[model samples]
Target: MRNGKGQERKASPSFFTGEKWLVLTGLLGFLLAAICGVWVILYGGPVFPKGDVLKAFSFNAALGVFLLSTAAILPFTALGNKSRALFRWSYIVLALYSYAAETVQNFRGVDPRFVKGGMPFDVWVGSIFTFVALLLILFYLFVAVQYFRPKAYRLRPELIVGIRYAMLAVLLSFAAGVWISFNNGRLVGLHGSIIWLHGLGFHALQVVPFIAWLSERTALTHSARKAFIHLAGTAYLVSLVAVGWQTYLGHPVLEWSVLPVLAFVSLLISLAPGIVLLRRQSDQTVPAGKAIL
Candidate 1:
């Protein structure tokens, strides 16, 4: 390939390795944890008086899903062969840290995030967990930086747009995480739960990309695809903002009001592409669009 001078040019590298292990492990963890959560919910009581372990497996299931979602997006990032080994090992360690931080700590009846304990729990486990979490945020920040590079121009327009917006939400989640660490609780204003906002921010990684993914499989004009991407991206961010606003105000996020209603409606709008895709799939009416890379 050449530029104005028509000289040969080597393509930039952005391939990700070890995504398969992350996907397989995460899926297995989710299924196993889900089964355990259900069984515990049916037949067990809280291991701790605070009832932390009672629902521990359920949250572990969610953590597993988080890993899977992260795996899904890593291939699209600008990671190169030179950095692949380090990133892959770091991800594995992070996965283990996440699993232990939630599951084992809960089983031991210790609060993973904000524990009041000593010895192995405090100096060892707690400090390491915080460091690991920071490492994850920093890792994603590196991905964000790579996405802005010219190599990212190789991405499809809508995919890149979705990735950018999704990264914003992720960064916002990191910010909320920092706030939680400082506050030592999920509670914010009044009854508002910062954790809820945090979850939404992270889940945007999956939701926004899903729309772009579906659009490639459905019959849509170029304008239509771009429009859907913008709509979903903007709507999702708006919903996040609305929730953040209400969260900061210390009110229930779903409290019946203009902001909450707007948030709910925007979320629905963001997911509308999926509904359309499903209906078309059922009716056998969706024409194939461009092949997804």
Candidate 2:
């Protein structure tokens, strides 16, 4: 495949062949759902319209179904022939079940909260979706491990690292979401900030991989690419922290404060790794008899 600039893009492994449409559909669902969420926030009044909220949940369920199905199928593309067939069917069945459960919950207007006096039928079904989603985290970890292994598929180093870190971020966000659900959708330490943390962490799956993809289209050296990934990821994490801190102090998400300054400083501190590596290279190039500058 070639990009718009006519650069030949790396072909996805055969394992993922014929799956591009599925990924695209999922992405579209996610985008539409995000737009709906923003619309609800802007136009649905302070309490929000129940209809819009329900529509958002419905669209979200569709997005989850498509996205999770894509995630579940990708691993099979790289698995050994013997294991591939078995795992493919297993993953398909699991993904379908998860998707069906989530869709049913949304259609039934089930509240996702774990209420007292035992959970309702639809809530129980919704919980199954959550459980299956969390279990899929192990599948992501497996994909990350496979990508990291020697003689594995020919993924770019930055892309592999991005996927690995994105997996971790997703895991953390999933755990946070589960915790919030159990606590009646209230955050413990950060109040409203847990939403920011969860949102930032999950979106790393898109952001980091995008950075890697764009870097690959450039004339960057491997070291430079790695440094860029580190810097971007660090800045991403710092921004998350800044927003979380601000929200924890009862500030709105868009409120400006010293947190941005702190986040900038933290991002600079994160560059210490790259800086140290550069200095080491400089020291190696210096003459034996030369005094250090």
Choose the strongest candidate by lDDT.
1
Task: For candidate 2, write residues 78-132 as lDDT tens digits.
Answer: 5575554544455455555654553343333444333234346655665776676
The clash numbers for all candidates, in the given order, read 1, 1
Cα lDDT for residue 49, candidate 2: 15
Report lDDT (Cα) of residue 59, candidate 2.
40
Tell me, by TM-score, which candidate is best: 1
Q: Write the per-residue lDDT of candidate 1 for residues 167-188, one digit (tens) a residue.
A: 8887888888887899888888
* Superposed Cα RMSD, model 2: 9.8
TM-score of each: 0.83, 0.61
lDDT of 2: 0.52
